[model samples]
Target: MQHQPDFSPAADRNKQPILDMLLRVLAPQGSALEIASGTGQHAAWFAAGLPGWAWQPTEVQPEALASILAWTRSQGLANVRPPMLLDVASPDSWPADAQFDLVYCANLIHIAPWPVCAALMRASARLLAARGKLITYGPYLESDIATSEGNIAFDASLKQRNPAWGLRALDEVAQEAASAGLRLAGRHALPANNLLLVWERAEH
Candidate 1:
């Protein structure tokens, strides 16, 4: 049988790091909602490796959604659900019956507008169970630390492509999460100047 091509070279490079983070942070067994599941490569690999979690991968773009579904079907990953059409900016776009133990989003912040990031936090806060985790991976600007020159250039290029597309300040994101009843749990520095930010829903 011919295999569906994996569309994301970046996903191939970052999947292991993402898996390592998920292994440490996510609950042993529950549903994990993945936002912007580009190409579904990461979803398939993660669902296959972490059999305990039911992975629901979603995408906003139709083409990407089709690719995600193709990958999910090709892998025969029973734990991974069909790709959902989700726009992070629209709260109603989220599934009404879905409540996740963990919410994972990768490489979205720098590429999307700032309001999308805010919406993501709010949506995750609403969808996550109490004390459930939300994890995001991407480049960010830290208050005290200078970004690597490569990342700086990359940020500029992203903004040039779309004025709203640029790296977000870590402190700003934390504040948004806080406003949405989520608190930053930790930030892990990954290879390639990326970061994995872990947040948890605030306890009542």
Candidate 2:
């Protein structure tokens, strides 16, 4: 056997930093829904780090399911649940039985089409507990900040691959989040010129 375990180099590099930030931002014990769990790496690592939190790792692509299940089982992570088939573009497919305190997704905004972002934001609002939060990590373009050469190149490459895919504007994303009833909570800079955006739904 190849022993591949479905790897993503970017995930390996950013997982620790992301976890470090989550430790400070997220509450001690809560339920988490991880969108677009590509290889299950983050789910495995984060679940291990926050043992008190229950994690539900979901992916839309069927091809990614095996690896996610394999990784979760292999790690014997009690806090992580089995993988769920979730497509941000398909709200009907989203699980209705459960809501979460923390909804986390990484590298999704630019890779997926624009509609997916709207769908995700809207659903996240409906799926959150009263004080739940949505956290997204990815490279973005901010009008005020000078765009890094590497990020610009990456954005160009992404658009070349899929005309609809590229780095999103921070203000545009923030506006979309607002329309979905989420407010900008905070934003953190990560390594590799990426960003971690936090949106919160406070109790009324």
Candidate 3:
């Protein structure tokens, strides 16, 4: 018998940068809920990096769950919780009973429909603690900045694959966040023309 874990070259390349930024932005004491934990690579890597951070990984696709488990086992990370089944498009699929200090979703919006984008914002808001943050990473169309040539091509490819799947405008995403009782906390320019938009749960 042979064992092979799912692989993603892009995830491999960007995980380090994302983890580095997370280290700088987050406190050492916080829990994380990772949505769309494809291949489980990021959760494994990040949990190991932020040893104090408890990480719960989730995915909508059943096929991806195996990979996540494989990576987590390989990393021997004690802080990582078992992966959960979560579909952002379906409100019932989200863990209504759970809350965390961080909601991390990467490369999910551009591939999902617009409604899922709104759903994601609302779901993140619901899952966050008072000062918890929802951090999304992906290429986005910015009203102020010119879209990079690579991102432009990537966006076209995504839309061609599925009319509803394409890079979302930053303003639109921000608006949805606001509607979800989340406010823009910070934005970081990442490599490959991607952006990490951080939204914090509004303080009552």
TM-score of each: 0.95, 0.96, 0.97
- Candidate structures ordered by lDDT, highest first: 2, 3, 1
Put down candidate 2 lDDT per residue, 23-141, tens digits, no spaces. 99998999999999999999999999999899999999988888888887788889999899999999898887688999999999899899888898999999999889999999999
Q: What is the lDDT of candidate 3?
A: 0.91
What lDDT is obtained when candidate 2 is compared to the true structure?
0.91
Each model's backbone clash number: 0, 0, 0
lDDT for residue 193 in candidate 3, whole number 0-100? 94
Worst 10 residues of 2 by lDDT: 1-10
Q: In model 2, how large is the Cα lDDT of residue 182?
A: 90
Candidates 2 and 3 compared: the better one by TM-score is 3
Q: Tens digits of per-residue lDDT for model 1 on 145-187?
A: 9999989999999999999999999999999988998888888
lDDT minimum window of 10 residues, candidate 1: 1-10
Error of 1 at 61 (Å): 0.5
Model 3, 136: alpha-carbon shift in Å? Answer: 0.5
Summarize candidate 3's per-residue lDDT along 1-204 as a digit string, tens digits.
323679899999999999999998899979999999999989999999999899999999988888899899888889999899999999998886988999999999999999988999998888888889999999999999999999999999998999999999999998988898988888999899988888997674
